[model samples]
Target: MARTGWLRWGSLGVAVLVLVVFLVAQRQSVDVSYGQSPSSSGTVEEGSAGELSDATVPSVEEMSALVKASPVVRLPGSTAYWDEARVNAVIGDAHILVAPPGLDEAERGRVRDVEEAGIRVIGTEVTGGAYQATADTLPDWRAQFATGDVTNLLVTLAAGIAKRPTPPDVDGFRWREPTAAEVEPVAADLRASGLHVAAGATLAKVPDSAKTAFPDGALYVALPRQPYGEPVPNFGPALVKLFPDKPIVVLYGEWIEYHGPREADFASVAAASFYGQAADRISRYAYPQGNVLHAYLNRVTDVRYAGLFDRPLPYVPLDPLRVALPALPWLFAACAAVFLALSATSLRRKAFTTTGTPARLAGLTALAIEVSGLSHDPSVVRGIAKLTAASEALAENLPDQHVRGLLDGASRDLDEVARALGRNDYLSDVYLRGRVA
Candidate 1:
C-alpha cells in the first residue's frame, strides 16, 4: 500500500510537470529589434507631416554632437531648460518637436527646412510668438505629438538669445527671467488647442487662477530651492495628480550636478512613483544643462535605437539541456513498474495457522505450568510436595467424607509423579509423561 501511494503521487507530479512544459512552449516568445534615424541640423517643424525618412536620420552619436555644440539655454530664474540641451544630445532628433505658440510663417518655414533635412517635426498651436510672450508651451507641444503625427519629440529653445545671467562655466549662453504671469495664458491657449496640461513642482505653486486655466497635463519646470541640493519630496506625486493622463518633464536646478546620488535617488523615487501610476505617460527627469548633460547625451546616443531599449530580446538560455529533457510520462511509467514488481513478491510469501483441540489444550497447559513455576525442573518436586500438604489442610476444614477422598487422590498423584521423575532423572521426559497422562 505504501509503495502504491508513492507511485501514485510520483505519477501525479510528473503529469503536472509535463503540463507546465507544454504551456510554457505554447506561450508566445518575446523578441526585440532596435533601429535609429539620422537627425537633421536645425529645428523641428510643428504640425502635420509624414513619417520621417529612415535614410536621413542621424545615429545617436550625431545627435549628441549637436547638443554638445550648443549652449545651455533656459528661461530666466527657471532650471527647466537646464538639461534641455543634454536631453537633446541623447534623444537626438527623435524627440517629438513642438513650435512655440503663434509661430509666424517665416519661422515655421525655417523649421520646415530643418525637417526636410531629416529632423523629425511636430507642430503645436503654441508658436514662437507665444513662447516669446510667455515661456509655458509644453502642453501644446504634447498635444501636437499626441495627435499621432509624431511619436517621439524633444523640447528645445528658440533661436533668440536669453536675457538672464549665465553660469560661469557656460559660454555664449544666458538665462532670461520667465514671465510667470504669462504661463497661465499660454497654458490656457494650449488647453484650448486640445493639449493635455499637467503641473510640476514649479507649476503646482502657480496661482490657482493659472492652475484652473491649464487644468491637467501641464509640464511644470522647477529649479531646486537650494543650490546644489536635492529636490523636495512629494514633487512627483503632485505632478502625477495634475497630469494623470499625460507625461510631465521635471527640470532640476542649475546645481543639479552637485546633488550627486541624491539627485538620482530623487529621480528614481519620482520615476517609480510616476511610472507605477502611469507608465504609458511620457515622464522625464532632467538636470540643468552642463557637463552632466553632455554625459547623459553621450550615453543615450551610444544606444542602438532600434527599439532595443524599448523592446529587449530574451537572454541567452543557461540550461538548454534541462529544457530539452524527455517527458515526465516515461519517468512515471518506470516508477509504476518498480512498484508493481515489489507488490507481487510480497503477496507470494508463505502463510501460517494453528488447528486441532489437542494442540489448543497443550498450549493452554504450557501457559499454566509456566505461570505456576512448576515448569522449573529443579523446583517441581518441592512445589508438588507443598501442594499435597495444602490439600490435606483444606480437607480437614471440609466435611469428613469429602476431605478424606480429596486428600487420598492428591497423595496418589504426587507419589506417582515423584517416582517417575526419580527413575528418569530428566525434566523433559517427566513433563512429557505427565502431560500424556
Candidate 2:
C-alpha cells in the first residue's frame, strides 16, 4: 500500500512536469510575422501591410547613430513601427519620437519637412502641441494645489528636487498620501531637475476624475490625512494594492506628527515591511524634504534598509521574478495539504482486520507440526521460535480486543511448543485447546 501511494504521487509529478515542458515548447514554436510596408525610412506606419519598406529597416548600429546625431529622438508611434523594428532584431538606445496627432495634409507636410531636414522623424501618436506642454517641460505643481500651506510645502519640495542631483534609474517621482495641492509641483520640480517625470502614472488622493489632470510622469500624491477612516497601519498595504505593477518607494517622514519619531520602533518597522514586501521597496525618513532632499534621493535610490541599524529591510521589487516568488510558499502549503489528505484517505481504506493474518497462519502451521510429534526436530523448534516473535509483533497492531487476545494466545502457544520440545515426553496441546479456534 505504501509503495503504491509513492508511485501514485511520483506519476502525478511527472505528468505535471511534462505538461509544463510541452506548453513552453508550443509557445516557443509559434512564429511571429511582421507586416510589409513601403516607407523608405523603415519606420512602420500605423495600420496594415505595405506601409514600411523592408530594405530601409534600420540596423541596430544605424539606429544608434541616428539617435546619437539627433538632439531628441521622438518616441515611436504605431504598433506597426514596433513590429518592424523587432523583426530587424534592433537593440539600441531607446529613442523618443514626436508626431503630428492628426492625419491632415498639413500635418503630413510638417512631418515630411522634419524628415527632409536631416532630423529623422519617427512615427508617434503625440501631437506637437501635447509634446510642448507635457514632455520634458517643467510642471507647475503650485497651481494644481490649493492656495495654502500644502501648496507652499509642495513648492518647496519641487525647488529642493530641482537643486539636488537626480537619483539614478528614477523614471519619475511618486508621492504617498498626496493632497490635490502637492502632486503637480513635485512632478514639475523633478522634471526640471532632469528626472523623467512624464513616464510615471498619476495616483493621487484627489477625486478619481481629477487624478487625470496632473501632467504626464507624476506618480501619486497622498492626502494629508488617512482616507475612509482606516487606521494608519493599513495605509501602506492599501497603497501598494493600488499600484501593484510599479516598484513602490514608500518615503515616510518621521517628523510628520502622525508617525512620531520612533525610527526603529518594531510596530512601525513591521507595518512598513508588510507594505514593502507586498510591493517593491519602502523607507522611513527622520527629516523633512526641505533640508534632506539630496539624502532623500539617496535613500530612495538605495532602499536596502528601513532605519539606521537596518531595523527592517526593503522587500524584493515587484518585477516578474518577485511576482512569481510569492507563489512558492502557497505552492508548498498546497502540496502539504494534498499529502495530508492523501494519507488520510489511505488510512481510511486500510482494513485493520487483515493486519495479523500472516502471523495467525505461521502460528497455526507451527502448532500443527508440534501436534504431529515434529516438536523434537531442530527445524520445527526454530520455526516455532520465529512464529512466536511474529505473533507478538502482530498483537500490537490489532485494534480489536478479541483479535489482540487471539494473537497473544497464539504467541504463547508457539512458545509453549518450543519449550515442550525441550522435554522429550511432554506434548503441547495448548495450541489446539486455546485461542486458535
Candidate 3:
C-alpha cells in the first residue's frame, strides 16, 4: 500500500475504535454513595405502635380532627418491641410508628383495628434509620393497597443523602460525592415529580446557588451542630435565612443517628430528634429497637402540645415545567435542522424525497416495538416509538398519522400515569447520578 493510503486507513481505524467504545459504554448507570452503618425490629406482636390503648384508637371524625389540629400526622403501628416506658411514650405522643415487613397478621389486624375505629392507619414512611430501608423496603400503606385497602394516598420516598465534603462530622460515616453534577438535575426531577425531597447537609454549608436551584425541598441538616449535649435546633424561621424559605429537619439529632452504643440506645437519640429541635417533623431512626418507638412518639406529642411550630414550618414546593420539551440536545438540533432545511429547500425548489427500503423501515419498527416496553412506562415507550416512527417514516416517504398520535397522546398519557403511580425517574436517578459523575 502507498504510505499516504496506509496513514489514512490507520486514522480511520482509530476513529472507528473510539466510536465503538463510546457506543458500548453509553447506557447510563447511577452510582450510589452508601451511608454509614454505625450500628445497626419485632413488633408488639400486635403491630400497634403501643401508643394507643386498645380503646384509644381514634374514630374517623376524631382522626380527621386530630390531623387538622396538629401539624404532624403520626403513623401508628409497631415494627419492633418496646419497653413499658417506650410503649407509654408512644400512646402519649399520639403519633404512631410501625414497620411494614415485621408486621404479623395479628399486628396488621390491630392497625386495621385502629383504622376501623376511624383513625388514619397509614402515615409517613422513612428510608433507613435505626431501621434502615433497603432497595426492597416498602411502607405498610403498600401492604394496605395489596390487600385491597385504598384509604391513605401518601407514601414517603426517601433517598440516601450525601453529606458534602467527605467524612461527615457524624462520625464513622462517609458518602461519595457525585463526579457528575447529578444533584441539581436529580433534585429538579424530584421537585418536578411533586415528591418531597430531603438531602443531608448543613443549611449554612450548602452553596447559595444549590439552595436556589433546588426545586421545592428541605435540608436534612446533620453536621457541624455536634450532638454533644442536646440539640436545641434553632427554632422559628431562622432556617429560612440560610435555606431561603425551606424547612429544616434533623436527620441526626444531638449526634448523628446510626451510631448509638446499643440498638436500644437509639431510643434516647430518637427522643432527642424531637426534643430541643426547631423542626416541625422528625425522623426517629432508632433501628430494630421498637422500644424507642414510644419515646419517639412522646417527643412528637410533646412538641405539638408545647405549641412549637405554631406558625407553619418553612415550605417551598418545587415547580417543574408542565410539559417536557425534549431534554436531549441531539433531538433539538435534529428538529431545528429539519425545519430550516424544509423551509429553505421547499420554498426555493422541489421537496427532496428521502430514499430507503420499506423493508428496512418495517424491520426497525418491529425491533423497536419488541423492546419498547422493556424499560420505562410501556405507554411512553410506545408513544415515543410511534412519534419516532412517524417522523422517520415521513423522511423515508411513508407518513402514518396513527404513529403520530401514538407519540403525541399515548406518550403523554403514560407520563401522567407514571406520576400518578409515584413512579420515580429511575433512569435519571441512576443514569444521571452516575454518568454525570
The Cα error of candidate 1 at residue 110, in Å, is 22
Cα lDDT tens digits, model 3, 50-118, are 322232334445554555565344444422221233223223323333333333345434445433122
Give the per-residue lDDT of model 2 (tens digit) for 125-212. Answer: 2223112111111111111111111222222222233344322221122234544353445445433541211122221222222122
| lDDT for model 2 | 0.32
Off by more than 4 A, model 3: 28-104, 107-116, 120-437
Better of 1 and 2 by TM-score: 1
Which digits, one per residue and each the tens of the lDDT, describe model 1 over residues 1-437?
78665764464455445545644665745454343322111222422121121122233444444434543211122112223444344443332223322233444354444321223222222122223211223322222222211111223322221323322222212223334453444345334542322332222232222232123423433433322122233233343443454434333421111111223443344333322332121121122222222222222222313332323654665865355545433443343334333322332231123223222223222322332222223233333333334333442455544534543443344334445446332333344456557
- Least accurate 10 contiguous residues by lDDT in model 1: 279-288
Cα lDDT of all candidates, in order?
0.32, 0.32, 0.32
Global fold similarity of model 3 (TM-score)? 0.20
Given candidate 1, what's the lDDT at residue 336?
Answer: 31
Cα error, residue 331 of model 3, in Å, equals 22
Task: Report, for all candidates in order, the number of backbone clashes.
Answer: 36, 26, 23
20 in model 2: Cα distance from truth in Å? 38
